[model samples]
Target: MRKFAMYGKFKAHPGKGEALAEILLEAAEQCKSVEGCDLYIINVSEDDPDTIWVTELWNDLEAHDASLRNEDAIAMIQRAKPLIAGVEPIKLKPLGGKGF
Candidate 1:
């Protein structure tokens, strides 16, 4: 089956980047207990302190979609919403990689 992946950037409001990243990290931990979740990574760059990058890998598109509706996931989203200024998401089809 083809894996589903998403590379997204979350722009935090003003100086809320670190706070937003922390929330996302919590979400990453929550994903560990979710079925079909392969990876959920939170990243930051010194060059962009107000931006948080997230990488997610799922068993398939359906699994990814279901995860969005997961209770923990929904709570995390709510917590992060106030800090988020904008979001940019890039969908990808995983072919091959070290993590794959």
Candidate 2:
């Protein structure tokens, strides 16, 4: 099966950047144990403190979907909704990469 990749950009509510980042970081750690989760990285934008990005690579679409059903992951997502002002997800078809 082909791997799945997603690049997500999150904008935090005014003055809520740090809080949003903390939640995302914790969620990333929790996701590390999920099956088929190849990579889950959290990044903060230096240019815009309120902008956060998550780069994820999964073994397949099923694995990525299953991760969302996790209790901890579900909880984290709910908690983050209030702090997030906006979110955008960009799907990627990774042909080749050093990390892979």
Candidate 3:
């Protein structure tokens, strides 16, 4: 079965990118331990200090759906809630190996 990937881009509070990145790093690690989580990573923008990108790959849709019910998943979102200005989450259905 093909996997699914989620890409998230969020604008955090001014001057709080590093702090938020620290928090997100923990969250990403937390997500990695989840059952269906293939990978989770936090990427910071070089030019923009307030922007961050999160990449998540799930084994399947069921696992991705179940993640919403997991405590750590809930906590991750909650932890990021206060620090974010806006969140844009995009779900991707893998067509092949690479996606631009």
Candidate 4:
């Protein structure tokens, strides 16, 4: 199966950086037990503290898609919506990776 990856950025609303980060962290933890989730890393931008990044690796594109339909993911998205000012997600085709 082909590996799939996603890189996402979340810009927080004013004064909501910490809150947004916490939410992302919680979501990452929730995804830990999810099937096909290879990696779910949460990061905060040094250049822009209010900007958060998440990089997710999955077994395949279908695995990634299925994750979105999970209850934990749905709840996370709803809880995060108000604090997020913007969201950008990019899908990737991984050739090879050390961690993956």
Candidate 5:
């Protein structure tokens, strides 16, 4: 299966970083049960508390779509509406592994 990844800069509202992180982490856990989710993670910037990022891997584009349609995802996004300032993610398609 082809690997799909998403990398992004999520700017959080003032005093909402921790709360947004919580929702992201929760979604990560919830996504494991998703049909095609391989990996989901959230990373924070130590130098910038208002910044956060995510790395997600899915089996395919279809799976990625399903993950986005999941109830948990919808819920999480809703919960995060007030906590986020801006979300701009860049999606990637993996070409090959280390030996490629």
Candidate 6:
């Protein structure tokens, strides 16, 4: 099966960037043990502290979708909801890369 990838940006409420990032980091850790989770990276931007970027790779699209429905993921989303001002997700078809 082809891999599934997503690049997303989460904008946090005023002064809540750090908190939001922390929560996302927790989610990353949880992904480590999840089936088909290849990568879950959290990044911070120096120019925009309120913007948290996530890069995810899964074994397939179904795996990525299932991860979203995982109980832990659901809880984390709820925890993050209040702090999230906006979200931008860009799905990608990764042809080839050093990381793959």
TM-score of each: 0.94, 0.95, 0.82, 0.93, 0.87, 0.96
RMSD of each: 1.0, 0.9, 2.5, 1.0, 2.2, 0.8
- For model 5, residues 17-82, the per-residue Cα lDDT tens digits are 888888899988888777777677899988888888887777887888887787778988899889
Candidate with maximal lDDT: 6
lDDT of 6 by residue, 34-91 (tens): 9898899999887899999999988899999998899999999999999999999999
Go through the candidates in order and give each one's C-alpha lDDT.
0.91, 0.91, 0.82, 0.89, 0.82, 0.93
Model 4's alpha-carbon lDDT is: 0.89
Give lDDT tens digits, candidate 4, residues 4-82. 9989989999878789999989988888888898899999999888999999899999988988888888988999999
Quote the lDDT for 3 in model 4: 92
Candidate 3 positional error at 86, Å: 0.2
What value does the lDDT take at residue 22 in candidate 2? 95
**Candidates sorted by lDDT, best first:** 6, 1, 2, 4, 5, 3
lDDT of 1 by residue, 1-100 (tens): 7899999899999999999999999888888888899999999866889989899899999999988888888888999999999999999999987988
When summed lDDT is taken over every stretch of 10 residues in candidate 6, the lowest stretch is 91-100
lDDT of 2 by residue, 1-100 (tens): 8899999999999888889999999998888778898889999898998999999999898999999988898899999999999999999877777998
Q: After superposition, how far is residue 77 of candidate 3 from its true place, in Å?
A: 2.5
Error of 2 at 37 (Å): 0.8
lDDT of 5 at 12: 98
Model 5 ranges with Cα > 4 A deviation: 98-100
How high a TM-score does candidate 3 get? 0.82
- Stretches off by above 4 angstroms in model 1 are none
Worst 10 residues of 5 by lDDT: 91-100
| Selected candidate, larger lDDT, 2 vs 6 | 6
